[model samples]
Target: MPLIPKSHPRAKSLLIREKLVKGFDNGLVAKEGLLAQGRGEAFDYLLGEKTTKSAKKAIRAAAAQILLAERPVISINGNIAALCPKEIVKLSKQTKAKLEVNLFYANKNRKQAIIKILKKSGAKVVLGSNISTSTKLPRIDSARRVVDKNGIFVADVVVVPLEDGDRTIALRKAGKTVITFDLNPLSRTSQTANITIVDNVTRAIDLLIYDSKKLSKKNHSSLRKIVDDFDNKKNLSENILEIRKNLTRGAKIA
Candidate 1:
């Protein structure tokens, strides 16, 4: 029957409907977890809200796999460019993955801006599409990216650092291995990925570079293992559980 004090600042984002109250009365244990929202407002969403030992292990495994791989690619988008430019470049250097700019917001100007940032960091680079792009869904088709069926698509592993849904699916269907950095585990992009690293882009990329640089030779089995181990259905199922279980959070704390 008690409630958090009105003075609590985090009360703003709360949307405790009658259903939650009813559940509480029904003896449902208070849910547990970090909220699913963009970073900063919700405890840095990629920090896992309440980062888990499992998520950490997954990230490390992913990094290790990439490090021990012969062919890998790091796909960059505007969000990644804006947030972790240096780290992106560093990982590319370490993994020797081709650095390619792929975005939902496609345009020649945007591509050039991303390229300019990467080139300044002294990283090897490639453009995802042959056509100069300034469009989104129109340019990068839903199931098919006008993306060179040759350049990035040919790589054994593709790291889509920050991505949208359609391209992730498209890349996999095109037969390229896909690794993605996504905070929302339930998202289509995350579930579809060969490796889903649920960590902050800045921190994750740094860890990835550190892991990749430690490798002396490629481990084809390791790469294949991640690809084989990932299960889209299970990932979504677990994430949904986490979301519902944690929905009854305490005083809003970012």
Candidate 2:
């Protein structure tokens, strides 16, 4: 990776790209993951490259849901492992949520690479490595359907950052509450998820961890109220409006 000057206008974005490129070289990210990151980056630009109020609300609700859940699992992919492995591990510890590596482009070496990163980041037990213990998710044919029986398969709530659409729908059908971080509010993964934080995962993940810690001290009923008060569709609509506002503002600036 090249040296990215902190004073550079797109410093954060540039650093994220470099990280993904390095992850690809390290076998922690697939070739397709680079392309996916590009798409999400475009949306992040539209979002003004910051976490919005709607995103914060969704993050709080997601945190509450995780705390209230009997079994909550955070599904990690190659990009997540490369980008924020330490934050992921912290959130897992804070929320007591299980960490499971699930990928669309699944391979043994890639899986091992991700697990190695997570463990190095202080994760004690990362699931989804052994195929013998894996179970198939209903209504999805993608490689992401192969889930560890003790993790996602049994989880009451799932935190899937940078997730695909079909699996979000499938998880819902399987009777699990799905929470996701997506830059594009209009994407299927954003729309289908029970709680969608339409923000950059790198930024929103830390907030989720913070909220998880704060909400953990509250009673179950208080946490339940936060979850009950959230409306995913409404929040998504607000995020869309935010994009429209940003476009209009940019046009005016031009």
Residue ranges of candidate 1 with Cα displaced over 4 Å: 1-50, 68-70, 129-144, 215-254
Alpha-carbon local distance difference test for all models: 0.58, 0.95
Alpha carbon deviation, residue 119, candidate 1 (Å)? 1.0
lDDT by residue (tens digit), candidate 2, 2-82: 999999999999999999998999999999999999999999999899999999999999999999999999999999998
**Model 1 lDDT per residue over 1-254, tens place:** 34656686534223222323443333221221012123322433323345454455556667766665567777776556545677788777766767767655456666676677677767655556456532232334542354444446566777886577788787777676677777677678888887777655655666666656654354667655654675645654555565555653432443
**lDDT of model 1 at residue 145?**
56
Clashing pairs counted in every model: 5, 0
Which model scores highest in lDDT? 2
Provide the lDDT at 98 for model 1. 72
User: RMSD (Cα, Å) of candidate 2?
Assistant: 0.7
